[model samples]
Target: MIETQDLRKEFRDGRTTKVAVDGLTLAIPPGRVTGLLGLNGAGKTTTIKILATLLRPTSGTVRVDELDPLRDPKAVRHRINLIAGGERMVYARMTGRENLWYFGQLYDVPRAVLGPRIDELLALVGLTGAAGTVVERYSRGMAQRLSIARGLINDPAYLLLDEPTLGLDAPIARDLRRVVARLAAEGKGVLLTSHYLAEVEELCGHVYVIGDGRHLTEGSPAELTARTGGHRTVRVTVPGASPEVEAAVTAFAARAGTVAGLDRAGDGALVVSVSHPGEIAGPLTMAIVGAGGTLAGLEVTEPSLEDAILALNDAAWLVTA
Candidate 1:
């Protein structure tokens, strides 16, 4: 539903130009949550602003549902809802319900549609209890909840969320993720940007990781993990392990595939990284036992999206450095 081809954005300072986004080419599939991940100042915000028609790109093309955000800004804006940093620009004097109702009116939603839209948004964001309270008295999380409600006021086909859960509590963030997932499942396209790796991994079907103002990688979370050789992180806890047993685990991990790295977490536990996951369990179990260590737990975990993105970011930095 959202596509960018060679998208670039630049800013001019005194005597130099800084590129905020560079040749970013990516797509967000309809009815799925596609996460846009990057460290702070890594062009994620720039890209989202361009796609939302709030900022014009320096070069290249961006289309949201076949309408150019730069050329057909009005049409694109009508079809998308862009919420950034949760409460960035919400009016403090209005009540939570008032905020959504105002947005619904701005979208020119029918008078008949406004009441239900406001009610549904308030309920969806768990702000029904404070629907009439002015936003100035609301806590940070409450205001954020209202912002989410505002984003849904028009029921736009595409939702562009930039750091939607950035500073919220764990419970609040979890609620927002569930709500966003539900929207995507209901056939709305969602493009999300987040630093919380677990949140992205849990909610996003595909992820586009960016660094150094460029696209580092884009694929399904599993696909990116597999591509980074990051899927085979194994955590093994043994009752007691001798030096020989540690050496054996290392050797077995090497034999399993490429040994990316290894570390020990706590008491007699070893975390090993294998490039590929195939046949890791049987060999590692045999090796530990053969070297006089009783296996306590041998569990395999896929590396998280954060880990994969950091790896990709490191690789991108290496290329430019």
Candidate 2:
């Protein structure tokens, strides 16, 4: 397991001091994927670097598998691997097979074991056929696959992926997600940082949202959405709707602590906002009907992960202010 307690990191530039991470605390246990999310300049990369023992924290505590990284940097490094996105970490002139073999050797894997491990990793990342191809000839996605394979050369127990699918096409990204899921299934503790909210929603069993280097919230996606006042917009088609029906719908929505907006479609449909749609759907339908309005159609749209994240950030700013 990897964990931190009140972790803090700062940078000094002559007369200016900048705090990159402020009292951040989180746990990444084995056999699951934990997502780290934040906006640009939010200290996400800095936090990852600190955890990897690439940079020492100014204060607070950090541990990997119960070993303090500061005092046991080499041991900690041996237990974890970081794959930073957009970085050309592979040797372009070497064959994909050679690159893996080189990294395996660097990690001190025995010659007898390194060969088979290289084969397995290439297959794991779907690069078995391209193993003999030079890294420079590989496409962006292929190089990324090789990068992942390189990171796993030592078969570390913990993996850190920063924007692993940053610039890939949808199909390529989906393939990478499958590899990530497979890694977790193999009992590796994975800490994934991505800007794709939908990707985080799909892959991460637990997510942590941070802003300005401080944690905003942490929970399962569903729990986070619920805590952020999960809402849905319900579009109700009510033809020939009278003023009484509109007033009654508006009043009901207000009582439920939701805002209501009405737009006259060519067919005269009313769109209503339901704060707690799962709980208010029935009542909303009844209210329109009970108010002497004929329902023509209804459509509901639920709050997305992006919406929940934004709400959390807004709440954090409100508190800080």
Clashes of 1: 0
1-321 in candidate 2: lDDT tens per residue?
Answer: 999999999999999999999999999999999999877877889999999888999999998999999899889988999888778689999999999988887788888999999999998888999999999999988898899899899889999998888877788789889988988988999999998989899989999888889988899888888888867777778888888888988998889877677778866566555556466777888999999988888788777788898888888778979
Tens digit per residue, CA lDDT, model 1, 161-235: 998997898899989999999999999999999878888888899888888678888888888877886655556
Candidate 1, poorest ten consecutive residues by summed lDDT: 268-277
Candidate 2 lands at a TM-score of: 0.89
TM-score of each: 0.89, 0.89
- Which residue runs does candidate 1 get wrong by more than 4 Å? 240-247, 250-278
The list of candidate 2 runs beyond 4 A from truth reads 237-248, 264-278, 291-297
Model 2 poorest ten-residue lDDT run: 268-277
Clashing pairs in 1: none
Each prediction's Cα lDDT score?
A: 0.83, 0.87
RMSD each, Å: 2.8, 2.5
